[model samples]
Target chain A: MTDVPESSRTLPKNSGIQEIRLGFTLQHWCLWQSKETPFGEFWPGGEVLPYNGGRADVSFFPMMQSRRLSPLARAVSAVAWHSRQQCGDIPSVFLSSHGESQYYFEILQGMAGGEGVSPSRFSLCVHNAIAGLSSIHNASYQPYLSLAGGTEGMFAAFLEAGGILLETSKVLVVWYEQALPDAYQAYLATSETTFALSMILTRGGGPGHQLRLARRPGKGGSNAEDCTTSLVQTILEGRRSAVCHLEQSIWQWSLDDA
Target chain B: MKNLEAELKQLIIDTLELEGVNPKDIASDAPLFSGGLGLDSIDALELGVALKKKYHIHIDTNSAELANYFASIKTLAGFVVSQQNKSTL
Candidate 1:
């Protein structure tokens, strides 16, 4: 964790072009999905190991002690815990949309039913719990930034990552969502899925092709963003880059040949 | 008495989410908290709710006599037996 000089650490917000350019190299990554039962089951015929219905391996964090993590925490932490091992004690940014829905539903249901709320569920209600556990498990004192708003947490997560990657050598980014319990099916988003993606990204500008981000469609691009799951599929296939349609603007991702 | 202690052990493991721990590992007369199982305040609250629901007994966590009932698996089983006996009588 050597310090990057303050002046050159983050990407400039306004670069005068239709797109503000920021570069980052992808080093190592891990993905997790836990929609199906029988934890750690594999999904076949895909670059990512755990597919939509397969379970995540919770044994990654043996020191986590309690097996009491909710299915979402297990899935989210499995990938996050692994990335910390892969990336070392780097700073991180955690993003999740509606991750609170799982335990929130449980707590509210219990409270409404007049049963004492499960204290574990209550402790886990905070979105930062995901980031908190990641830091604790990694034994890193570095603050893991937490972002938990809007349907497009993945895109927002990267935007924040770009800011830090500009200043640091590497940043671990974890983006995830859990399958909303059956009771909340009506609120599901098209991009949201019960999956997580972990990445250790290095500061951009090196020899091999790296990922460069800008406002999609140039100045007047259509506000169409790729869903998080599909973006991963695109990246998995070794595509040049992906686009994420966001509010009012689209995020265009492309490979920068350096 | 042994059966009741074993039952209590499984209940604690299941309700508290103690991964990789076995019922046989828990000492029946050992403390359930504070240097024994090392469970925390939240675990106590959760266990209290579970005890009330399972035994159909009223467990006031704030009561002065509560510690005696939960000091160990042996004490918990004894409390349950006494409560059940009183109800049946």
Candidate 2:
């Protein structure tokens, strides 16, 4: 991958907003229910409702090679399964906080016990496992990124994906997280065990879609919520989801819903 | 045997992140894979690693007797204790 400086690359002037279709949203959790199943029951009670009037065709159990697959890999599988219906080729953005937390925990435990950490776990501990998995699954071999931004991981990923869509024509953005074991959970303050959100964006005005960009005026205003929640609300409200800038407080609501 | 089974069940619950499951909920001699605990292959691999780490009992995946060992938490703990006794001897 070539390194391109953000400042050097000029964004296209006609980077007009386009209506990217909500293809599919897959969620996985460890719990079983008669009503539905997630990609894996890694996170129970997780919901993915799309506005375009489609059932969340979720999967319940993890894949066969799930032990080998990192959290990001599972997340990408959810996204890829949904994106198969639309165009196969597109830029992708992956986001996760405790990326490979289980592996990290194992490595730490090994080190504490005077046993060397596994080389395989060390090699895969980075934040990009999901992107690699997605690329392999789609056979796209396109440029993608894995991002970690603490509690704001999902929002940051959304912003980056939006930027990619603005630069290129369209992009697929996925956000996912796996619950850390209790020992690790005490180390990192996080809530909502596991969650994954995927959205496809294209440039060209279409029906029932919009994007907004703005800046935060000051603090002590509305508390921050993860981008996943916003996207879910948008879909639930029957409005197109929007991506807002990280520095700004922008809201993307469907005018039709209003 | 019942006490050992309960302890093994708790260990499985703690190790496998089987949220909402308790030692009291699991029955001794119940099948751990499909019928009892509903654990998958990944869970087996993880359990294998955990067993080795905690009990210092190495499980040969290729062993035909491996299924008997992992039949249930009760069986697994008994296997571990037996291995421990053999090592001491």
Evaluate every candidate with DockQ and list the scores.
0.55, 0.07
TM-score of each: 0.79, 0.50
In model 1, the Cα lDDT at residue A246 comes to 60
**What lDDT does candidate 1 reach at residue A203?**
75
Predicted candidate 2 versus true structure: per-residue lDDT over A58-112, tens digit per residue: 3433432333454445555655556644656777877766677778878888899
RMSD of each: 7.2, 11.3
List candidate 1 stretches off by more than 4 Å. Answer: A1-19, A35-53, A63-66, A190-193, A207-209, A216-226, A256-258, B1-3, B64-68, B80-89
Candidate 2 displacement at residue A174 in angstroms:
0.5
Alpha carbon lDDT of each predicted model? 0.69, 0.54
User: Clashing residue pairs, candidate 2?
Assistant: A18-A204, A27-A39, A28-A39, A28-A40, A29-A40, A29-A41, A29-A42, A30-A41, A30-A42, A38-A59
Please give, for residues A106-205, the per-residue lDDT of candidate 1 as tens digits: 8888889887777777878888987787677667987689887454436677788888866787898888776567876664543445677787778776
| Candidate 1 total steric clashes | 6
Return the top candidate by TM-score: 1
